[model samples]
Target: MGKHVVCKVSELPPGERKIVTLERRSIGIFNIENSYYALKNVCPHYKAPLCKGVVTGMTLPSKPKEFNWGREGEILRCPWHGWEFDIKTGKSIFDPHKCFVKSYEVTVEEESESVETFEVTVELGAVVVHI
Candidate 1:
């Protein structure tokens, strides 16, 4: 596997997604709960950058009998089409088998002198090209 240094871990904030272009490819890195995950930045639905989408989670009904509900922290909604996806697996919530984003491998390395600062590597995964 080839490893490409993307950016420093300090550049990203927790629970946020950042878009970075590597080797002419647009990739997204998400910092969630002290861990990192990478995916293609563009949404499969409309080619919109997924980094611009809203980070959300599973919704639980506020009132079991009522239609109102609250978010639960497992999904992300596409900003352009409102499509939701499982953040951990990049699978579409609406259709599990049919749609998914290309996921990448990420590695974070810390400087020997300090644990507060680190570097990040983003590895490209399966390429998905829409026809």
Candidate 2:
């Protein structure tokens, strides 16, 4: 497994995401409250651009005639079929165990922790994605 330097932490602030191509594959790198997460850009259902979809929360289970919204900014809704997924785990809102999208590991690397081979703006911390 190799680490790909996607972008600087300053570039992608909290509640923001960036779609990057690494090894010819499109991947979405998201920053949620300063924590970085990476997910495959393609959606499992109908193969929509999952990363390009809306980054919002989901409606939780509520009683009859009641409405509740939770997980703010942690959900990704597919634009094509409106399929919702958990950005953190890349799991579908409905069938999380069986149906899901691929997720990658992300880490924030400081200048002192990075190697010389990888070129990134480690001074401000860089988002390194592993695939």
Candidate 3:
């Protein structure tokens, strides 16, 4: 597929997400820890807006009857089925192959053309996601 401009780099802040309609398809663009990831809005398990689901990390149990919480805002839970999927890899934690959402390649293009910071010039651009 071709590349499309979803939104500005500043528009989607960290720990937030945006649903974009492109090529007659709905895609969920997420910004996690300044990193961006794109995932098909449709859940492979079922036709659901997977992007609109909960944005929280998973729980790992240290042992039986014990639970450990880590990696906050790095996981997404389906709203309808509660299926957990890694936002970065788009792979289902429980069922890697059988269940998964399509992940798209996302890229960020800064808005500014060029800038000098402490004797260093950097080019700031916007966010352009390639599916």
Please identify which of the two predictions, 2 or 3, would achieve the higher lDDT against the true structure: 2
Pairs clashing within candidate 2: none
Compose the digit string of candidate 3's lDDT tens values, residues 1-131.
88788889889999999998989889999999999999999877778788999999878769888889997898999899988899999999898877788899998876666663443344476554432
lDDT per model vs. reference: 0.76, 0.91, 0.87
lDDT, candidate 2, 1-131, per-residue tens: 47888888899999999999998889999999999999999998788899999999988999999999999999999999999999999999999999899999999987566555754444457666433
Give each model a TM-score: 0.70, 0.82, 0.79
Worst 10 residues of 1 by lDDT: 114-123
Root-mean-square deviation of every model: 11.3, 9.2, 9.8
CA deviation > 4 Å runs, candidate 1: 60-73, 112-131
Error of 3 at 61 (Å): 4.9
Counting only residues 3 or more apart in sequence or on different chains, how many pairs clash (N, Cα, C under 3 Å) in candidate 2? Answer: 0
Residue ranges of candidate 2 with Cα displaced over 4 Å: 112-131
Show pairs that collide, candidate 3.
109-125, 109-126, 110-124, 110-125, 110-126, 111-124, 111-125, 111-126
The TM-score measured for candidate 3 stands at 0.79
Worst lDDT window (10 residues) for model 3? 114-123
